[model samples]
Target: MTLLYIHIPFCDSKCHYCSFNSYVDKFELKSAYMEALKLQLQADLGRFEIGPGDILSVFIGGGTPSTIDPALYEPIFKELWPYLQKGAEITTEANPNSATSSWLCGMKALGVNRISFGVQSFFDDKLKLLGRAHRAKDAIDAVENAKNAGFERISVDLIYATSLDTPKRVEAEIAMAHKLPITHLSAYELIIEEGTPFEKSPNVKKESIEQSRRVIQSAKDAGLEQYEISNFGDPCRHNVGYWEYRPYLGIGSGAVGRIEKERHYPHGILEEYIENPHFKKIETLTDEEILEEKIFLGLRSDVGVDEKILPAQMLQRAYLLAKEGKLRTREGGFYNPDYLLSDEIALFMLG
Candidate 1:
């Protein structure tokens, strides 16, 4: 089966810790950028036409997709809605600051069924530290508005590792996330990317994985099952495609397609993506690589994997980790119960 992704590259303000293919040109460039995207999509349609066995999952990801002028949406939706599969999963990535009830209503009217809100933190001070534009109140209010606008499936995002982000604080965020109406939560640790402004700053990478583990466990304690290293949900669909090694097509700037993907990189995903939209350096994986990825991704999830598919070496290590309660295996393969500890375990195993 095949899936689709559409990247949206606009944010109300640049976060101090972001290094994606986004610009601060919010005024003059917004309209023109949308036009450019339309041109690109028009030029790309022939090569990516729909076929049988396709599962359409259009994700409007971003610098911040919700910040875009809603005016740009209708024309594109009109042009492309004809080809969508009957039970398609159409989602949009939105920042809390831009997710107003009217905006969500318009999106629902235009066929968006899923909404993923970028709510880095529910504490005002932590929000400021992450350079987020919205207050915690805005996030709570946005989710409420999204529900009122008829969104049946909603996802929320949280950043785990940050200064002042104690295990207790992370646990508190988990408690808050559980109480909210969102069905999915992508709770990720803050990693400082090279060349991002925060990378040069001293405190951006201050939190440890050991401390973060407590917070992730706190989420599990709150009923949000860890489905992947950074994602959690019930009946997760979008991310499962990635972990389970399903085919997908990604469009727009900085997005990567895995319909046919190579494990090795071209050093810079953004540079190559802008220069060549063929998912430059893309390769259809060999069976071996696909199997390796399946074990790797499954081990990171609470769902675990099938025993026969796991490599012998990975199985041995999984047993050792399981004895320590760091990982567990059932009739299925293995899973990192405290997935927040996964990074350190991977590093140690690799070393």
Candidate 2:
């Protein structure tokens, strides 16, 4: 099965810790960018030999896809509808402040079955400190609006481990999230990315690793399953598609796609993409590299690698890990309980 990813690199404002290829001053290029995205999608239909019933999901992520007028998505949707499988999960990421009632309604009407809000936190003070444009109330309102717009699969993002994220604060956030009409929760730790505002004068003081574990336990107690390291149920299908090594088509600036072992990356510059949609660099992954990804990605999520693909030595390693209580065997593969150790496990097995 294949997945489709569309990137919208426009945001009303940039967050302090964000290093994404988003721009606030490129509003004038929005229309052209959308046009280019469509062209790129059209190009993929030809280049990848993809047709109807091939795509399992479509995820439109961004610098804030909510900032773009929902109407702009119509053209691309119309082009993709003929090829969309029945019940395909179509998702779009929106910022709480920008995803108003009308925008949410329009997206829902346009076949967006799932909505993920970039609600970094449900606390106003933390939101402000994170350079988020929305307040806590706005996040609540936005989720309510999405629910009213008929989105049953809704998700929200949360960041923890900052100095401001006390145990009490994390509990409060989890409690609030559990009460919301969301089916998914993506909890992440604050990282001071290079070239980001947080990297220069980082105001964030990280909470202890134990605090992070507590946050995960809290979400699980609230009934959200930890399907991945940082993501809780209802985990987006597009995310699972990646861990399972499902091929996908990537459209728009900074989007990457993989067809079998071949990887495709389009021009990252908005203007450059608009100028030439087909300008992309392609790379083919070696069999060894693909095998490594299977182990690395499988150990990080609920999707486990195929035991049939494991070498005798790696199978022994997994058996040892199981004996150590670090791994479990199920679904004809081995899974790790501690995702943090996934990389190390994969490396050890690779050796």
Candidate 3:
């Protein structure tokens, strides 16, 4: 079963740490972008040979999907309905400030069953530091409103380990998040991506392992299981599709798609994509590259790589690593306990 990811590249405001291909001044391009995106999706559906009952999940992520008018999503959903499975988990990432009750209800009516809020923190000061458009109360209201609007599966994102963040702060955030009707939580450590505002900001600090562990323990205490390094709870199926190396389609500017061993990337610039929906760059991955990805991606989540896929020598190394307590074996595959060392373990086993 294949997965679909649609990227919305519009945002009301750009966050300090975000380097995503999103724009705050491009509000005028929204309608044109949506039309172009739908066209691309329609063309891709035919090109990929996607038919009725072939898709397992759909994720609409963005610069801030909530900022867009939900009515514009109808056409795309109508086109996708025939291909979606009976109980496909369709999700949309929304911002607290813009994910109004109306937007929530509209998306739900359009087949979106899950809503992931970009609630980086439940503190006004932290929100300000992160350049978030929403306040602490806005996040609470958004979740409550989403629940009231009949959303069952809900997720919230948390950013920890910023200079303004502390162990107490993370614990408090987890406590508050647990109190919400959220089923999943993606607690991430703040990373300063180069070329972003945070990269040159002295306020951004390096995250410590101990700080992360404390935050993780708090999430676990709040009933969210650490299924992946940064993700917790039952896990997002669409994201899991990526971790398991399943072929998926990506639509919109700067989006990447992978079908079998072939990968496709539409133009990174929004204007270029709008001019020609087929302005895509494609690459076929080598077997070695695919294998390395399998190991790397598999180790980062609940689904570990099958031992059968490894060479005999690599399998022996995996066993040795398991013995040393770096990795754990279960269900006929090796799993890493400390996801931070996943790269090191994968490389060591590869050697």
Candidate 4:
């Protein structure tokens, strides 16, 4: 089964800490971009030899999926309908400000069963600090709107470890999320990425290991189990497919896909992509590189590294870590109990 990811590169505004390939002034190109996406999707579907009922999941990610009209998405859904497996998880990411009731209901009509809202925080001040366009109440209403629109699997994204973040603030944020009709919550730590506004003001991000721990504990207390370091509650099948290294078709500008050992990157520039949606720059991955990714991704999430994939020395190191209780061995794989130490553990195993 193959996973499919569609990228929408238009946003109402760029966040302070976002370095994603998204454009705020590209609203004029929305129609053209959607057409380009279809072009690429058609070519890729044929090239990848994806047959009916072969698609495991579909994730429409973006600058803000709700920015586009659901009418525009109808064609894409029609194209995918025959190929989607029964009960396939179809998700779309939306901003609270743009995810209106009409928008939510429209997307649900197109078979998007899941909606992941970008609700970084519950505090209006924190939202402004993060350059979010929505108010605290907007997020709450958006989730309610999604529920009213017949969405059963709803997710919210929260950002912590910012300068204004405290243990109490983080707890309050989780408390607000718990009150929502959401089945999943993804609490991510603030990473001031290069080329973003936050890069110039590095002080905005106050990295605190304790703060992260607090966020995790709060989510757990709210009944959202931590399946990955930054994720909680029910696992996203599309993301798990990625961690498991399943083949996927990345359709759109700035999107990426991996088929076997080759990674395919569509053009990053919107104009360039619209001109030639079929074009792709491919990178071949070596055996060692793939294994390293598996180890890193596996350790970072509940998806443990399979013992069969590890080399003799690496397997021995995993055994040692398991002995020390840093890792747990189960079902021919080694799992990391503490996801916060995943990077360090991955490095030690690599060494």
Candidate 5:
């Protein structure tokens, strides 16, 4: 079975720290882009030789999926309905500002069972600092509307480690999230990406290990298990699939897909993708590169790496780390207990 990711490159407004391939002025191209998306999906389904009931999960992410009308998503869903496995996890990301009751209901009717709201912070000042269009009340209302629309698996994305974030403030953020009827929470540290507004003021991101621990402890105290670094509560199957190195079909401009050792990238330019959605730039992965990814991705999450996949030298290092209590060995796989040290541990194993 394969996973599917559909990207919507339209946003109501761009956030200060967002460097994702999205545009606020391209609303007029929404219909044509979605149609092209269908064309690409049809071609990919055939090319990938996917059979009925082979799709394991579907994640509709984007510039902001809530920005597009649900009516435009009907045809795409119709095409995918035949291939979706029973009880498949279908998710869509939304911005609290645009995900209204009608929008939430419309997506629910089209087989989206999960909603992940981009509610960065609950404080109005913090929201303004992050350039978010919605206020705290809007986020609360949006999540409530989603629940009212019959969504049970709701997730909220929060950003921490911002200039305005303190340990107390981070705890309050997680507390606010806990008050919501959410099954999952993703607490990310603010990373100033290049070409974004935050890039101009790198100090906007205040990296504090204390804040990170506070966020994690707060979520765990609230009964949201820390399955992965920055992720708490019920695990997102699509995200887990990615960490497990499962092949997924990426549909839409600026999206990516991986099949076996090959990674595929469609045209990033919106208009170019609309002109030829089937066109893709392919990159073949070497054995070393694949192993590196398995090591890093596995170490970062609960998906431990199989010992058989590691070379002799790396396996020896893993065993050493396990002996030192930095890593845990279970069922012939090696797991990292402290996800924050994942990068350092992976580097050691690689070296």
Candidate 6:
């Protein structure tokens, strides 16, 4: 019941709203990085004594993993291929501009089953404003290439905020997404992360709450249902493990893994290569903490907490919300509201 994540910390360029631990340079060290990752995996398995179990999922996220030549990926895949069982989910994050026909086909042949593209916006203006290197056309082309190459599960990541983002714009974006051959969609609200250029811009959407709601409604209309507060997909299996708080492993530079015994594993640097991979920290969530997390995350999805186990206080809150026509019980649990931003108001009200 563990998940493995590999973080490729190199990218061709950094986006304006990005706060993740990724950089635009140091891809030259990818070969060394791969060697270190292999050593790290071997050492980790030894320390953990992970049995010959299914590799539940492998996620290779990046500054830009697609930018690295597939030849460098060969060794890592060779070592990992042995551990994979049938139905194991493997996902990679690729930038639209970096994705091409050849790259998609090569990874698929190697059993890479899923791809999540970074397609922030369809409008060229939004793309430029976000500092994305790919235009909407590139996104269209990438998804088509992936489908033609036999990828069955594809997810696209989008961002919303700023002056140009309106309910109409959000609807339009989702409408455009419907034309593409993708199975999943993960849309996020704009957050002015620290040290990013957007933090200094006065044009940032401080009060775009209404606009956010419209955007989400647009997505639902397109049949991309909301599974979590920020993420939307089929929803993808990777997200199920994540939202359900299932166990997983994290590898590569700056990657984080939460294992048993309250331990976390991280690959510290993209600059230096190591024969053996190690972690910077392992965080433990207390019993109370895990309970709280379940409530927080569960409430964000369309299917909220099971009524049987829901806290008495939460049930009371739900009662009040239902009375107000803001919450409704369904087959799984409870739905907050039909609107997109309802989750936010629900969280605040319930909190």
lDDT of each: 0.72, 0.89, 0.90, 0.94, 0.94, 0.75
Residue 205 error, candidate 3, Å:
1.7
Model 5: which ten-residue window has the lowest total lDDT? 207-216
TM-score on alpha carbons, each prediction: 0.82, 0.97, 0.97, 0.99, 0.99, 0.88
Give the residue spans of candidate 4 off by over 4 A: none
Tens-place lDDT per residue, model 1, 1-351, is: 566667777677888778777655644556655665565555545555655435556778877788776778877777567656777788898988888888899899989899999998999998898888999999999998999889989888998788778767888888898788989888887888888778878585667757666765776787776667777777456667666666666666656666554432221333334444443455668876776566566657655556676567755766777788877667666666666566566544333
Q: What lDDT tens digits, residue by residue, belong to model 5 across residues 151-251? A: 99999999998889987888999999999999999999898898999999988889877778888899999999888888999999999999999999999
The global Cα lDDT (0 to 1) of model 6 is 0.75
**Model 4 Cα lDDT, one tens digit per residue, 1-351:** 999999999999989999888999968999999988988988999998999999999999987899999999988888899999999999999999999999999999999999999999999999999999999999999999999999999999999989899878899999999999999999999988989899899999887888889998999999999999999998999999999989999999978999999999999999999999999999999999999999999999999999999999999999999999999999999999999999999999998
lDDT of 5 at 152: 98
lDDT of each residue in 1-351, candidate 6, tens digit only: 667787777778889888787767766677788778777777776676666655777888876779876777787888776676568898988999988899998888878899999998999999998989989999999999999999999988888876677777788888888789888888787788899888888476544666667766776778777667666557667667766677667777677676643647564656543534664566777865665565565667654656655567867876777787777778746665554545564565456
Candidate 1 CA-lDDT value:
0.72
Which has the better TM-score: candidate 2, or candidate 6?
2
Clashing pairs in 3: none
lDDT (Cα) of model 4? 0.94
User: What residue pairs clash in candidate 1, if any at all?
Assistant: 305-333
- For each of the candidates, give the backbone clash count: 1, 1, 0, 0, 0, 6
Candidate 6 vs. true structure, TM-score: 0.88
Better of 5 and 6 by TM-score: 5
lDDT computed for candidate 3: 0.90
Off by over 4 Å in 3: none
**lDDT rank order:** 5, 4, 3, 2, 6, 1
Which is the better candidate, 3 or 5, if ranked by lDDT? 5
Clash total of candidate 5: 0
